[model samples]
Target: MKPRVSILAALLLVSVCAKAQDVNVEVLQRDLDHPWSLAFLPDNKSILITLRDGELKRWTPGEGLSAPIIGVPKVWAKGQGGLLDVVLAPDFAQSRRVWLSFSEAGKDGKAGTAVGYGRLSEDTKRLENFTVVFRQSPKLSTGNHFGGRMVFDGKGYLYIALGENNQRPTAQDLDKHQGKLIRLTDQGAVPGDNPFVNQPGAKPEIWAYGIRNPQGMAMNPWSGALWLNEHGPRGGDEINIPERGKNYGWPIATWGVNYSGLAIPEAKGGKVAGTEQPIFYWQHSPAISGMAFYNADTFPQWKNKLFIGALKDKNVIAMTVNGDRVNEDGRLMTSHKQRIRDVRVGPDGYLYVLTDESDGQLLKVSPKR
Candidate 1:
């Protein structure tokens, strides 16, 4: 049976230099169970999607969604811990290798983020020889804040973003894996030139530290810089370009107050002495997630712009990037009324988005004729 297609005409309108821009949103697939992330296959027509409930699925046009691919690692599947992100290997066309990041369980109910890889069987129904590559150290008791976003850098090194597991002070600890960005080789070995590889008490895989719960990460196509967005307590969501050995103050310095409406005691102010500042931050956080850069010719007006998913704000933010600085251009799909989970630029040059809901949807955005 063919999945129903819904056309939402002119769902986005943005004024650009006295001209009105119209966007068309087409529903591609629906009824996903809290879809977390998506990556396009080499063919560009097929997609791999990860559900928060620990299922992996493939979607192809006309064929609808495929059955759950077998051999996914067991996930905690509680709170924020579950199957989170998926990406194909840099040599996926010849390798058939797929990588995954998820929350893995430990003794006494503790859990932490883990990364693994496996080859997709020729039948596309199972994973073969799946091997876990990395696991966070000192698994904590909390289930929330398992930052499971992963992206490969220009040099093919895999970068993994981690959360503090609701344990705030750990964000400042170099000895802990929580609240850190890690860089490792494809097989999960620590890169020798990493900033902390020679440091006495730091994890050799640590690329940067003091992150909160980063849910969005992407490599800028133009500059080859790595950028990420993370959640804040009550406000102060941030977009940062992480550099080697840099510190991004979390509990120690922030623009957000606690969820209880009280100020965070450890935080002195928005800027601390040694921590790097965000290029852009939201005073009232939108709960940002996945991100992508628009370098496609399909929408010339959106060329070189960055698009980020907004869960709380229920819109996709378009930002203009100038060197290390970013400016908000506009918001799209504001009237859609769904939590945007992930955003990616398709191989065909259109924008693809995933809505985070039990009845979530995959949407394709293009210029309205």
Candidate 2:
């Protein structure tokens, strides 16, 4: 082929790929007021969503939004503190029980991730009993970066991802519960089957440690492998698949450097013997927050793609996944880019996205054409 003709063909290929990548985004009920998290009931008739400022609302098809679920825990509501993820118990249809994670204020105004349980009133008008079950030990003063995404594995164990809380040194310490993924019973005790259960002086509650600000975390439907995305200091954002009892190189080992361009020692040699390496990493820091694997039939073509929301870029990126490899695909950059908070697949197979402003909206994805 001639040089000019080859160049033209290459350009045409690029245009075609760009046109194939598109997602139609729409505002499905704005004025959400910083809605931070969401979960769907078994019935698929309603979605239970939480506002950072302590109100929980239910959205149904014809009824719009019912009044907020009252009696939620008291929250700090300043900085990165507020009501967080709301998950239904595995047997919630019969139990009517729900689990919530929030930053509860302790003595001296300290805040920590406290997992609590609540009962949905008959009319779905309120929450009752509302008991605090598990709380992170030694709550800190800086109320930020509570990695509160919760999931229940098929083994009936609850997996909780925790943030480093800006306390870098503690990330490698076994004494601290922050900066770790913990395996706990529904009643909040460290299960005997956990990886670190027999380690001495180490918290048995820890399933995996050495995480920084894990903003987005999820489990793959096919592999059931736990995957997560965490923010880096300035660059070095990472997507990791942690193994039980493994220490992920956080401040100690990362591809990112300091925000001011100062050199921090590499967390470790990239191929260190026992350490877990991130499956994917972004050197420029996408400021990733929430993540979910697409298994819904609504977008059958997008099945198994990983969706992650970027705060700094103000875009929702869909990536193609093949085993551990991911390549970027489509993106929906909305005008309401107030820091995309979380992205999860709804029961109906649509995408539900959250934003991070004092008054943010819950946006939905629809067909563009």
Candidate 3:
């Protein structure tokens, strides 16, 4: 069944007030139940979507939405845990393999982030020989802050972002996998050259540590480096280009205060030894989620800009990147007032976003012709 968009009257007023003129938003699909992520298929017209309720479905331009695909692994659908990011393999054309990150539930109601990959069936009805390749160590009882975004660098390695599971101090612990970025081979094996492979107690998969709850990951097209965006407590959301064997100083030193309106004890000095600083940070947190770079011919004016989804302001934040420092350009789609969950530049050279809500939507943004 095709669902129609029901634009609210207040949204119409906001459109008139905001003057968003560069691109116009078209509601492609509506009535989604808290959709989390989307990945454009190789064909450019088809996309695979994941819902927080643990359903995997495919959408095409002509056929609308297909029935939920089969062979999804068991997910813990608690507070902030569920089916999350979906990404295609770097060599998906020949391999037909796709990757997924979700909250893997364990015994005693504990759960943690996990990464898995499998081949799509010929008919697109099921996943064949699905396997959970990696699971975060030291599973916690908290249900929030599962940083499940994944990005492939076009090199042989794939990177997965994991949160600290609401246990702040754990971000600094190398003995545990919490609050770290990990790199793995296409088949989930640890790369021999990974920074901590020789460390006796450190996990060999860890590429960088001391992140809080990162929800966005992307490879910079020009620099060939990995970048991430993570949520802060009260403020101080950060954008960092994670380096191998570096500490990002999460609970130990953050610009944000505690949620109880108190200062974080470890962050008193604001600078810690041997920790890296963020390339950019938000004094007023936007609750940033998805990220993408605009390098498409469709919108020549938006080229070389980094686009991030802002949940707190219910809009898409655009920034101009000069080398590493970023300056806020403007906001997009604030008229819709929806929590933007994920953002991507489709193979067709257009921007696509997912709204995070019970009655969410998939929207396509294109230059106004």
Candidate 4:
């Protein structure tokens, strides 16, 4: 059965584009400090974006950008730790509520993924009354990876992805918080409907376990299933659809190995039953950042496609999705060296992108002549 989708006809904004015929993209704004994630508000006229340097800024088309909105909680802001994904509640306009995922330091100074929810000031720019909805239990400092991506299932339950924090063994240790995809309520409470909610010694919040550094995540446009992309050391990037109580083989099993030129035996072996396999895998990894499903009508050519931005590849990947599986189709870029940090589908039918640079830029894509 085909999934019904709304026609994407709304144009976000109209300005004298660089050029409609040649599709030249202009730097509407520049000099951003390590922007990580961006989410459009319900209005589709404004946006809330986060920076890896621990700042959140609101941006719009005509009036340009707003000064950094305060009220973000203190973040560790080290290596891979800092402010991350931002999303509005399903009833955002009425509730004025939103969610955020970030990395923060614990007593031992070790940073881990933390989830929080707060109400947005009427302007939907800054946050208020921020509270930790979820925090990694028995936190340990594994500074490298904290998959702080958040997605809400159809039932209004929240799903979060946490990284392995560079500790491979933790991905398999059921007792630890590392390498787990969690299920929670809109307010970050454990949903009683969780697969293992009644299991002994099992964390009720855990939906699936075993992820390395899952930075890229999206909801399947057709199946409405959740998709994830995790980092690989040298190669072997993976994309998986997590199932309840399943263990995605990480550390103990993978197609890639360590970066120090040393091959960890486990990274190459241990693929057995009961472990979930990725729908797609990338060798010679691209260091993926963020992902989205392209359902925009502006680019009927790219309808039903998946867009993934990469840091190492420094390009925006366009993919074709048939059901839950995918095929890499095209790689688009502005031919610049700036790392691609994030990819998002605008409410209007365009692709808005963020680059990873000391002085980064936020760009939008339209038709090319």
lDDT of each prediction vs. the true structure?
A: 0.87, 0.76, 0.85, 0.78
- Report the lDDT tens digits of candidate 2 across residue range 1-369: 111112233334324422334567766666777777888877777888888888889988777777877878888787887888888888787778888988878787777787888888778887889998678776773877777888787677888888877777677888777888878987667788888788787878889988888888788887888887888777767788777888887767766677778865545533355566676666566688888899878877878788888888777777778876665566665455568888988877778888876667777875454
TM-score for model 2?
Answer: 0.90
lDDT tens per residue, model 3, 1-369? 110111232234234433444668998899889999999887778899999989989988868788988988878999889999999888788878879899988777889999998898878889878899999998983698899999988888989999999988888888888999999997799999999999998999999999999988898887888889999888778889999999999988777788887998777444677787777776567899999988778778888889999888899888777766666667788788999999999988889999999999999987667
- The reply for model 3, stretches above 4 Å from the true place, is 1-22
Off by over 4 Å in 1: 1-21
Residue ranges of candidate 2 with Cα displaced over 4 Å: 1-20, 265-273, 334-336, 367-369
Measured on C-alpha atoms, candidate 1 has an lDDT of 0.87
- Superposition error at 34 for model 2 (Å): 1.8
* Alpha carbon deviation, residue 248, candidate 3 (Å): 0.3
Tens digit of per-residue lDDT, candidate 4, span 1-369: 111111111011111111113234556568888888898987878878888878888888887778877688888888878898888888887888778899988888788889898888986566899999889775765568888988887677888999988888888777777898998988778988787789887778988997888888878867888988888777767778888888888887676677876776566453556677677666567788899998767778778888888899887777678887666656677375679888888898888888988898988876575
Q: What is the lDDT of residue 295 in candidate 2?
A: 86
**Cα shift from native, residue 182, model 3 (Å):** 0.5
Tell me the tens digit of each residue's lDDT in model 1 across 152-214.
885969999999999999999999999999999976799999998998988899999989999
Would you list the rank order by lDDT, best first?
1, 3, 4, 2
